[model samples]
Target: MVSHGFSAIRYETEVKTNGLSSVLMAKCQGCHQKFKFETSPQLLNNRNKSKHYDVNVRAVWGSMATRGGLAHLNESLATLNSPGMSQQTYTTIEQEIGNMWGEVVEEDLLKAGAEERKIAMEKGQFHEGVPCITVICDGGGVKEHTNIHTMRLEGYANSKGTLPTQHVCYKNWDESSQAMESNIILEGFLKAET
Candidate 1:
């Protein structure tokens, strides 16, 4: 797989040289939003630097981070390192991978929820033309026994099964306020039309 990826990138570089390099358009795995980035054929061929400078390489990095978790990324990077590779290069790649993982792509998720709700309404699964939904809100301490606690809200449509329409997390300073936060989240969801 790695060899094929390298060959594909090499082929693209060789075939396209109108402006000295190729501009690779990468998309987010979650939101499917395209982002443009440029990379040179020389950079791709260089053995001293990490190939992550290339947009294709960055997409692979993001996919790996999203699918296999960070441990796998760390292991892969360890093998890719050469004696000439600088620490800064590895740091940059790791940072990019971390950023990819950190993105929740909430916009895409919200769109999906809206579509699901529309389908459910058409099917007449809702109660009295109103959506039959579940508002699950909870708050608990962090790390099991830790004092830090946070309230979270998730809305589930009956037709949507386990999928949630929205998921929100709210910080809490005191355990007593947790119930209030949960109530607020539930009330807000209940008031909103599906």
Candidate 2:
């Protein structure tokens, strides 16, 4: 016997009459029986007719991903939805349940990121007058506001213009870990030639 999961159900006429009572209807996997369950109005509204999962919101999320790290995603989104920008309507930033960001969007973003990195690398390359690309590597540690120690290695290339070409970072949990991370970054830079 195949145990298929419950299929989604749509309520047609009773939506307004029931205060949108029933959110889901599903068929049992084992017995193949159908059932409907009452859910919270919030859940029903958010799941059935969510403004958060629309295309424009998704496009904004993609924009946020390109701007920086995930830590800043919500902050940037909130700023975008501030009073001045409220008329634009980018308020909903919640991830949909069981929904994945599709590969088409992901692939497009990945390609764009790769292109940006390539352009930055090209910009870092030495132009005329300088015989060779001046490769500079440095590593250091910083104590963050959260009191966590983080170590990072920065690589720069100079010709006519000086630009950072690479960055590697890791948590410095202990002295030994910090040493190991620094050595790894140093080795990586040494292995790469401009």
Candidate 3:
């Protein structure tokens, strides 16, 4: 006789691309709406991650402050690093500081938000929320070990129409080839969607 171990796994997925697909339903439920559309892919890989760049921006700033040419900039930066600076003033100072520290590159955080908005526009999710298509997968029985896996949508259907979006992301996996599935880390979209 074989004993089956009890197991449960959970994970959240995001619409990386935010685009929609045409889920035509000439017949849905008890109605014949004959609806047609261009749906967006519903998965992490498809979801666009422009906002993530802001994180990079911060990391870059921190790293720059501690390294080479920009190393000395830290002292100057400390003066303006108070917690009481007005939001507006802090932003201006931060950007200036970033530039003065290194290449400066892009400054305004609002501008960064705009960049994310642009990507959301392409996916039609900038305004309207994307719908999630769910599939109950029967994962094999779990024993002393747990495995993680990410599922990417190759195609999708929605109200607009169908189109292919190029993107990929880590959805779920066994956590770095370890049976330690108890400690799951969802840094970004890896987070559970509400």
Candidate 4:
């Protein structure tokens, strides 16, 4: 007679993680079988040719949305008894995000400039054979003695009531807050000339 044997097999599990993503790996002691499971998909970073977990990028993005940094993210993770990312990893992700934003900002500025020029051309607003768009400058700073200042330049639609103002330039000033407006205006005009 043939007899079937029943036995309980043991498996060892290990977790590997990056940021909010984790991978569960298991190995069967008897059969030596291995299995792996991922909590998040890995994404490719085009600029650096590196791979990153999707959740890791999302976590950094969420931190940036709240204007927080690595410390803040770590604090939140610590409360949940989760491991925090290394500073080097955080910096790499932050730099990648910053680079992406820089490209977007440049594209937006170019589009805004193009739209302003088109509006000026349609209205026949020309000076010395160059299309001249009306630009409105505004600046503000803290009420206190802080020297920090911010300025924005908007392309005004003027007589065209249907068209809204388009932002052309935004800049931060390190000089006296009171004097920032004039400086920013001058800088805006200089930039337009080029």
Relative to the true structure, how large is the alpha-carbon lDDT of every model?
A: 0.45, 0.40, 0.34, 0.69
lDDT of 3 by residue, 16-101 (tens): 22111223323233332344432332222122321222322343345334432122333444566611222232233344444454
User: Ten residues in a row with the worst lDDT in model 2?
Assistant: 145-154
Residue pairs clashing, model 4: none
Model 2 lDDT tens row, 93-184: 32332133444666785686466556657777534532233333343452221111112112223433555333323333444433554565
Report the number of the highest-lDDT candidate: 4
| Angstrom error at residue 15, model 3 | 66
Query: For model 2, what is the error of residue 131's alpha carbon versus the real structure, in angstroms, after optimal superposition?
Result: 51
- Ranked by lDDT, the better of candidates 2 and 3 is 2
In every candidate, how many clashes are there?
0, 0, 40, 0
Best by TM-score: 4
What is the C-alpha lDDT profile of model 4 across 1-194, one tens digit per residue? Answer: 12246333333554677777878876655566778888889999888898888888888888766756677888999999988977767767866886788899889988988898999999999999998876554556432232111121112343444453332223344476767666756776789767
Could you tell me how far off, in angstroms, the CA of residue 194 lies in candidate 4 after the best superposition?
Answer: 4.0
Q: Each candidate's root-mean-square deviation in Å?
A: 17.1, 18.2, 29.8, 13.5
Q: What TM value does model 4 have?
A: 0.68
In candidate 1, what are the lDDT values of residues 116-188, reduced to their tens digit?
A: 6787777766877665544455565222222111111122244456554332223333345556657656665
As for model 1, its CA RMSD to the true structure in angstroms is: 17.1
Measured with C-alpha atoms, the lDDT of residue 110 in candidate 4 is 85
Per-candidate TM equals 0.30, 0.18, 0.16, 0.68
